[model samples]
Target: MQHIRALSAAKETRLTISVITFDLDNTLWDVEPPLIKAEYAQQQWLLQHRPGAVDAFDHEALLAFKTSVWRRHPALAHHVSDMRTQMLYELQIAGGYSEEESRSGAKEAFEAFLVERHKVVLYEDALDVLKRLAQRYILGALTNGNADIYKTDAAEYFEFAFSAESIGTSKPHPAMFKAALQKTGMTAKQIIHVGDDPDHDVQGARDIGMHTVWVNAQRKPWPSGNKPDREIVNLRQLPEAINHIADAR
Candidate 1:
């Protein structure tokens, strides 16, 4: 809370908020199913194409290998797509494939994963609240992941979207929040960033002077001791919660 400032009201707070930034992954939809399905698809591709990839690399082994890769290359942490691609590419190379074959297979394999990755099933109330909020405020998406709005058919709601890859930094980093401010031509005080993550969304935005709403869709407790301006059990409550925040200012 040391980084947080008093939420002074802007003139625009009398009407609509200057902007509303959203977290993509767990906030709007469940991310795990598509990701799991995508990974399974990738393994299937490997088994069908490669000789011994299935036996040599089962689910447990592949997960461990990915973890080790991420730990080894801290620089690529911001760009998960690149990390996944590079990991598969290197694994194929290690499996005796030529550089061209490995590169092609890796690229193809990632694209296969991406198809299911973007097949996100939004929460029952996510779209409703987003549409309601979008009518009154500027909407932007800020995420640490690489889910494309066009792929998810979410482009209509968001004025713009930024990810860790696009921002050249991840959430919980000052740079990501700074970039949002830069793009919107608004001060942090003028916007409210809503997300599920206590650290990345609440802490990061509040640290930079923005008001925050903790979308605790999971019913998790506030573990960090830093409180968000508002907390709601679901996005259905978001519109009312935001109104309360706006009125308080």
Candidate 2:
């Protein structure tokens, strides 16, 4: 524990602390519910709006379609709008709709899906943790999803929010981290990133000199080689981690 404290202290002084950029999806809330709702909404729209075009388009079918499309265009996976459009186009083609009809139905279905996606219920301790952290750190969000953090009512707690759509790059890419640094006017070492993804949040931020906290809510195993500076199973532990980082500074 002393060695851990010393290492934490040494890393803290490398940069002046100010901003803390978080990952929005699984880090803040259980994303599966909203995602499941969105897909369900899309399927209902297809059945009602497109009718005969899709007789058996269900949640499972949509999931398979989404996976297939993402495998084909991994970059598109980061942009919700793009992914929505792609789903509409693919569904239209698969259902044998005419180009014009497909486009029309896709537009309507996508909008319907978007409405359902916003009904996200955050984790129990997310707001409490954010409020506590905000007292000491300038909070922000770094996400790959298309939901506008400002629109989520959590914007007041964040100084600013960023996404792959806004930054022009996704996580695991150094450019996104650089953008966050530039936006906050802080060096790489100044901020600590908390996220659920090992590759995108932990490794990406660590690679760029930022300390990280892995929110292992699911008890996922840490990948070998790349490790986060801190790991916690819940948001209640986040404030202590931030304090540790601040104390080192």
Candidate 3:
């Protein structure tokens, strides 16, 4: 294992953090803008190709349909991409298309959504912070969403990336963190997981004994009495937070 030694400020003893795992969406970038754009893109596809469906279903209706689809197929709940595609397929069928046509149309509409979805805007300084952090610690990503870092500019900095789609489960389930630990051959204490979500990211990693850094850009109060080991409002504060956690060890 590669270790970077730093003198603990509190204990004045050597400490090391070997790996840093991250949550992609809302952590590295603002996810809402692109998601809105992606939804628009999908709607545009429906308007052009499945006009009746577009006319019948508004945003709220589509959302309801998506929920129905999800409930119908509980086994694939973790697969967001698949769930979306399935919803599109149902929409196409409802639009008076044949089964074969609905299948192909759903696939194409999903492609449209994905193209826009991948066009995410990274938060300012996120790339620079990742670049700096990558130099010292082994960097990896664990995302609950279907966003693929490989398709984004952040791919180069990450040693490995896993999504709930690939792992068959999402964060807060130990499987994601355990997979990272297995992949990096590092113990929970030797890794730090950073993310924006209070439940999935902060509490999830902490549950498994890994250090956590909550990116509370919204300035929300800590939900529970048990708080994260470290907190920051932006990516620029990330390195220092990691150091602070390391120093305390």
TM-score of each: 0.91, 0.86, 0.92
- Which portions of model 2 miss their true places by more than 4 Å? 1-14, 56-68, 71-77
RMSD of each: 5.2, 6.1, 3.9
> Which residue pairs collide in model 1, if any?
none
Q: For candidate 3, write residues 53-123 as lDDT tens digits.
A: 76787779867887898999887878899988888888888889999988998899999999999998889
Residue 218 of candidate 2: its Cα lDDT? 92
User: RMSD (Cα, Å) of candidate 3?
Assistant: 3.9
Error of 2 at 223 (Å): 1.7
- In lDDT terms, which candidate is top? 3
Candidate 1's residue-wise lDDT over 130-204, tens digit each? 887776677888999988765665667787788999878998998888887777666887789999999999999
Winner on TM-score (1 vs 3): 3
After TM-score superposition, what is the CA distance of residue 232 in candidate 3 from its true location, in Å? Answer: 0.3
Query: For model 2, how many clashes?
Result: 0
C-alpha lDDT score of every prediction, in listed order: 0.82, 0.79, 0.86
- Order the candidates by lDDT, highest first: 3, 1, 2
Tell me the lDDT of model 3 at 17. 79
Per candidate, the number of residue pairs that clash is: 0, 0, 0
Question: TM-score of predicted model 1?
Answer: 0.91
